[model samples]
Target: MKTILPFFPLNLVAFPGQELNLHVFEPRYKELVRDCVANESNFAIPSYVKNKIEYGTEMKLVNIAKEYSDGRFDIETKAINVLHVLNMQNPYKEKLYAAGDVEILTNVDNGDIILKEALFESLTELYKLVEIQKVPLNTDFRVFDIAHQIGLSKDAEYDLLQLREERQRQRFLLDHLKVILPQLRDIQKSKELIKMNGHFRHYDPLEF
Candidate 1:
């Protein structure tokens, strides 16, 4: 279905089921949040990548986390669906923030169990290598829910927004893991070495 939504362009990508907390300090976005909360409306957070607005996620404003003295606000939102921009109008209807006509993109879960398990395991291991002991998992989870947690880049996360198939998203994130896990391990190893520097090392000189 197509509809118009308030647009809040951000440098970050918000994935489905992800909770995003935003500070609304700008005059435009402060008004945006107020309107959303008053009307119980959802807004689009278009990923501002490479100086251009691209694909985005539709998010429901959950609550006003806090309100500053100067009328600024801290708000919490949850990404509920993906949005494909039909077009956007800046200063929409003379309002401060931009608005967009968008089409909702639905996700297809083929339930590729093997692929899901593989991706999940790899994600867990990636966190483990970084000494993250408890990684959260939803019993019935979509790949989008964990994409941000698995170290996918903002660009890659935006790419995932375009994908409808769960298996495909899994593969996309797995590729990110393949590239990042090794680098994280190397970094961890370096950190370990740095910490061990100046520690006492008592060993036999040469036992040849």
Candidate 2:
């Protein structure tokens, strides 16, 4: 069934069964949050491509984590469904709230525990490299979630959001990591070479 829904365009992709914490400071989105809170309806979190793609995920407001005196909100939301936008009209043009018709997507079936485990192992190794390099990251999730964070590209993330089934999503994550790991290995090797040569930042100008 197609329904008109409130739209929030963001730079990131949200996946079903995953939690997204948002800081809502913009006035239009504050109103959008108010509307969702009042009507108990889900909001669409679509990616803002250069030309605006019509695909997005629907998220349910889980809890209002915090509220500031300035009427800003820190809220937690969970992706509940995927929606394909049929049409969009910028109703609140000043603050950028869009109204659109979206069709909910059905779930796909594709799960393999072995694949998931292998993906997790690969992700853990990647995270270890980051940690050893002292890269500033506040990664607190398990290997699977971490893989989802680092493995997915902007477009791939949008595609993952459109996937309805948990199993298919896991498989997609696995496939993503399979392709990403080799590249990560090359990056790690390059970093190690730089470190052995007195780090990239401390390299002597005359060495070139």
Candidate 3:
């Protein structure tokens, strides 16, 4: 069904069942937050593509993680569903928000157990390496949830968001990581070689 939702355009994509933490500082968005809190309405987060895109995810406010004295908020939200934008009457005219007719998406299945298990294993390995390298992540989830955190390119992330089948999404993620793992291993090996020489820089630079 079509609904007029308060819209927030972002540089990132949000997936169903994922949690997003946002710091809302703009006045219009603060108003949006107030409206949501008062009415329990869901908001839409569409990826901004120079021009606004017509697809996005519907988000439900979960908690106000923090509130500044200035009325800004550090809020957490969960993706409840997807939406297809039907029309944008104003096109980003709002200071910190937008409005549009978004048709809610339904019928996508939850992920399968086997795919979830495999994804967890791959993510665990990935995070172990990340931890060893001392990268920091604010929130944690199962391996499947890591897909929501890794910095996939915009188009790649949009493609992932389009996969409606749980197994298909899992397989796509597995394939994506399989391609990435080799490159990551190569980078690590190169780093190790450079470290052995006490330079702590890329080994290829030594050849120069």
Candidate 4:
């Protein structure tokens, strides 16, 4: 479905099911926040990267955590869904914030079990290489839930955000993890090799 969403362009890519705590400091956005809160409505944060606002997430303002004496706000927002911008207006007519006609993107969760298994293995290894003790996946988790934490670049994250299928996102991340995990392991081995007085040492510590 289509929507006329208010735009708050941010440099970071936001994903569905992710909860972000944002500090609203800008005057234009402060006005936007106050309007959304007062009207019990929501706004959109278009991903602004490489000097473009192409796609973003529809944010549901969960709580107005605090309102300062100076009209600043500390708010909690959750990314509800991904949206693609069809048209944009800077300052949205008379208002100081932008607005746009956004197309709510389709997101399907019909992924293969085998692909999910592969993802679990690859992501677990990925976290291990970073010395992170816990993998975020615990039997039943989603790719969108941890896409931002897996060393993905801004462009890659944005690419993933545009993908409409769960399986597609899974495979994209799996391929990325597969390609990067070896490089990371090699870098780790180089570090270990340096520690070993420059002797060539090969080690396999990360389980697939």
Candidate 5:
């Protein structure tokens, strides 16, 4: 469905189900936050990449964490869904911040079981290689839950957001990890070799 929402253009991509805590300081966005809280409405975080706003994630205010004396406040939010911008309105009809008409993208989790399993294996290896102590997998684990830590570039993340199917996203991420694992292994080997540079080593003599 298509609807209009207050647009907060950010440099980072907001993944589905991601939690964000924002410090509302700018007058325009401050106004937006107040409006959202008052109306109990959700807002859009349009990814501002390449000096343009296109796709983003929809979010709802969880609470106003703190209110500073200078009209600035900290707010927590959870991403609800993905959004594709139809049009943008700066000032949003007299408000300082921008707003947009967006088409909400429903996430499809019809991923192949095998694909998920494979993806999970790759994810596990990736976590091990990166030394991430905690794996955030829940009952229904997904790529969005760990996208931020998997070495994806901003552009790659944007592309991931554009995909609606869970399986497609899984494949994309799996391929990404596959490409990275070899490089990581190579780097690890290089590190190991480098560490041996100034150390004494024992050699086994072969008997003829």
Candidate 6:
């Protein structure tokens, strides 16, 4: 099914089940948020990359955290689905913000059980290396659900959003882990060395 959605172009990529809190101040976006809230509507956040808007995610407004006297708003939203841009309109129908007619993409979950377990372990190790503790994810959590929390770049996350199969995304994640683990370990080792530099280590006097 196709639909015309209120569009919010952002530099960040949002994944399904991901919660995003935003500060809405721009006049156009302020109107956008106000309208969505009043109508109980959903919006699309397209990833703006390299001067072009590409794939995006659909998010439902969860709540308005606060509303300022100047009409600015702070909102909390959760991504509901992914979308592929079919076409777009600027200042859609004389509204302040842009609008896009997008096709909702299919989200498939066909990951290999073994590969999924490995991905989970790798993510855990990565978080540990960075010294950040993540909450226990639900049993139904898919890899895509945590891709952003696991430290994928904006570009990488956007790329991942385009994948239609779970196994393909899993493979991409596995490869990313393989490349990132060593780099993270190297960083951790450097931090350790830096901390130890000032410590007193007994050294043997060389025969001069």
Best lDDT among the predictions, by candidate number? 4
Candidate 2: segments with Cα more than 4 A from true spot: 92-96, 132-147, 164-171, 190-208
TM-score order of candidates, top first: 5, 4, 6, 1, 3, 2
The top-ranked prediction according to TM-score is: 5
- lDDT of the structure predicted as candidate 3: 0.76
Q: What do the candidate models score in CA lDDT, each in turn?
A: 0.85, 0.73, 0.76, 0.90, 0.89, 0.88
Write one digit per residue (lDDT tens) for candidate 2, span 28-130: 8998898889999889987775457678788899999998999899999997777888888887454357778889887664456676666557666767755
Residue range 1-208, candidate 4, lDDT tens digits:
9989888889999899999999999999999998898889889999987678888999999998999999999999999999999999988998889998999988998888999999888888888888987666786888898898889999999999999999999899988988899999999999886899967778889988
- Against the true structure, candidate 1 reaches a TM-score of 0.84
Clashing pairs in 6: none
Model 4 vs. true fold: TM: 0.91
Clash number for model 2? 0
Error of 6 at 182 (Å): 1.8
* Per-residue lDDT over 1-208 for candidate 1, one digit per residue giving the tens place of the 0 to 100 score: 8999999999888888889898889999999988998898999998887677868889999988899999999888999998888899999998999998999987787768887888778877887886777877755677876776776667777788889888888788778888988898899899998999999978779977
lDDT of 3 by residue, 62-102 (tens): 99999999999999999888778887755455435678888
Per the 3 Å backbone cut-off, how many clashing residue pairs does candidate 4 have? 0
Q: Which stretches of candidate 3 lie over 4 Å from their true place?
A: 49-51, 65-71, 91-97, 110-114, 131-144, 197-208
User: What TM-score, computed on C-alpha atoms, does each candidate reach?
Assistant: 0.84, 0.71, 0.73, 0.91, 0.92, 0.86
Off by over 4 Å in 6: 133-140, 190-208
RMSD of each candidate relative to the true structure: 3.3, 7.1, 6.4, 5.3, 2.0, 3.2
Q: Identify the superior model by TM-score, candidate 4 or candidate 6.
A: 4
Residues 10-96, candidate 5, lDDT per residue (tens digit)? 999989888999999999999999999899999999998767788999998998999999999999999999999999988789899
Residues 60-90, model 6: lDDT tens digits: 9999999999999999999999998888888
Candidate 5 runs further than 4 Å off: 200-208
